[model samples]
Target chain A: MKKLLAAVLIAIFSISALTSCGQGLSRFSVTYTDVFDTVTVITAYAKSEAVFNKAANAAHDELLRLHKLYDIYNEYDGITNLATLNRLCGESAQPVGKDIEILIKSGLEYAALTDGKLNIAAGNLTCLWHDCIANGTGLPTDEALIKAKEHISYKSVKLENGTLSFDDPKIKLDVGATAKGYAAERAAAVLEENGISDYLINAGGNVVSKGKKPDGEWKIGIQDPAKQTGEYRFIVAVKDKSVVTSGSYERFFEYGGKRYSHIIDLEKLYPSDRYVSVTVLCGSSADGDALSTALFCMSVSDGKALLKQKNAEALWIYENGEYEKTDGFKIYE
Target chain B: MNKKTIADIILVCSVVLIAAVMLIVTTVNKKNGDKFEISVGGRVYGTYSLSEDRTVDVDGLCVVRVKDGAVYMESSTCKGGDCVKHKPISKSGESIICLPNSVVIRVLGETDADAVI
Candidate 1:
């Protein structure tokens, strides 16, 4: 009788274990602030804290590597980063890394698609505005901006045989518009490669979602450009996708009671003001990043056509508080 | 019923009751929080209980206050007091970040969303 009771108890315990097999997977998160001049938060679900830590650390390291490669002002030892390429590529065809080669190729493609509105080669013009914003010295003079703009034509940037060269020595490259999103997408892959399938990488405003949780899809809140941070305009349910938002409100300087955003328009040689903000949902965060910035500089009709070409959906919020979203965007909501 | 059969039934019932209690405890624990966490420079500064109303000065760079089951930034030395102006966060995963000072105050519990972009 005693042996039979013991067997029954074992059977009950085994059944309970099988029923709660996946209960060990818990949500864990880590934050890093030293990359890309923004906050990077990785929230993931794993069986143990140790496993989550291992995966999150690997992702953070990947982000750091990409951050150093894309950095324009800072130079690190033993790495021929973008700054080095910018300085010497104008003189000769400089040997480049595969990451940079891919970035510049995609950047040039975006520049052509957007008619130079999203030009990575516009570093010369952007730097002038950057200096002004950094120093709080107000806006850059139109004279200096025009001179810098002349060096931005995409034809001047060349990449061949794993080498990058500039037709114009003065041409500089700024990946500000695309680097954070690209890095977030890469970091998400790093998490997956480390056996973390359920995760989300929020690199500032660029969010990349991997697999959904046991409960349901991840809910991502898009910030309202006219309101304060943490204030959401919409909450979208998604899995295995990227959502990126570009707004004139976050990084801007107030000059003469007017705001000049960081996203410059080559045609006007000033901040693009057609829309207050543009948010894009796509498979690649890099493409979403470029599209959001480009769409911010375009009209609603033109932006819709471009979104259709890429099969991406967008929500455009005009300066007058009116908003428009693509036909398919409502499905996520 | 036989004595052996009655004994087996009681054993299984007790085991099921214990498992249900354990599951309930864990689910409640994950969903509710009486504490909040503070991080600076991507490192956790400290965790404080929301049950106790107190003030925390973060490396002399900013001040955080816990009151009535909510947490908020009371003051900051950063150029913009955006953190101070932010609403008090009481729910899980709600956070207020002061970018310049690299200070973040977040409620400690399971969040509705995995993240906010």
Candidate 2:
């Protein structure tokens, strides 16, 4: 009986020790659900009590600021400011905010990099589809699409000395594809400047983790695209990296028994049916965002080649539900 | 061992636990001494740091100034400048939101800063 009692006590102590060892970090999250249509932000950090509070407050402020900068529907926003200034046909220069300029430049660069697969100036095509969906009608006619396509050119949107102008009055700028990622990057910079070392920012599905957990690496779960909730695929342990995934599963409309993805193909002026989702890991949220969108528009073979060339990593899930990952992904079971 | 020995051990363990808790609390308070500020939607809100004097301009929106351990919204385009209505925030989780300009102000401590998600 004495020996059995001792064994039980020892077991209890060991279990307690194991649990206590991994339980020092405090977690706080602020959810801003209104922006990005239906997207939310969940920011977590590990720090002392006071530090945690301070960090959370700062992050909340940053998120609100980013929303104002990126809201496409907000007519007074800088993106709209550009649109209004360029409402008349022909090139007319308009001064833009630094943040807007960076986003525009990034959008054009990504467009060129992905062979025009990801174009912010493709707003004309996007708007037509948006209107169709809003009105509960079918896709726009081919003739209407062609007319819209004439104004959908990233090359025509010029940027110089913090001024942006468009050659076409119908040309609009949509940063929906990359704005969240850019915001995450900027928020991370704010935290770094304030001396917060270990944190994770999850803007919708895009995640950026900086520093490491007490045990070393940050463990993140990549949700299964098929499931509405719960972890489906695998967990990744990383340090100081950003992981962004773009998928049709998040937002879409079904018409005539067919599911149309939200991500539109600039050249075809229609929804893409290439891959189910694309996940990219990189050092910056902006890069991860751009690459994830671009990869979704490319074939598996081409995406693989591009990832290899860029020395970046990706996980591609095809329409058949089969998935392939680049060699750089260190997925943990 | 007798009950006396068990009681003594329990007492020691309890004392150690309390001490650890106190130590953590002290560490947290120490790190939180500095005040940080954040502005959202062109409204200034945050904890005023005694050591640093800083000013932020939202450009056609608002300006926030922190000086001598107090922070205030100095100028704003919004009606009534109601962001100035709130008291200066020095602790964590305090915030000021300017709805018109879509800006938010917050305070942060050193260790709890960087988050990417």
Top TM-score prediction, candidate number: 1
Instruction: DockQ each candidate and list the results.
Output: 0.36, 0.04
Off by over 4 Å in 2: A1-25, A46-50, A77-91, A133-136, B1-117
For lDDT, the strongest prediction is 1
Error of 1 at A44 (Å): 0.5
In terms of docking quality, model 2 is incorrect
Query: Candidate 1, A47: how far from true, in Å?
Result: 0.8
**Please, what are the lDDT tens digits per residue for candidate 1 over residues A134-174?**
66787888889888988998888988888889999999999
Among these predicted structures, which one has the highest DockQ? Answer: 1
lDDT of each: 0.84, 0.68
Q: Per-prediction TM-score of chain B?
A: 0.79, 0.55
**Cα deviation of A84 in candidate 2 (Å)?**
3.9
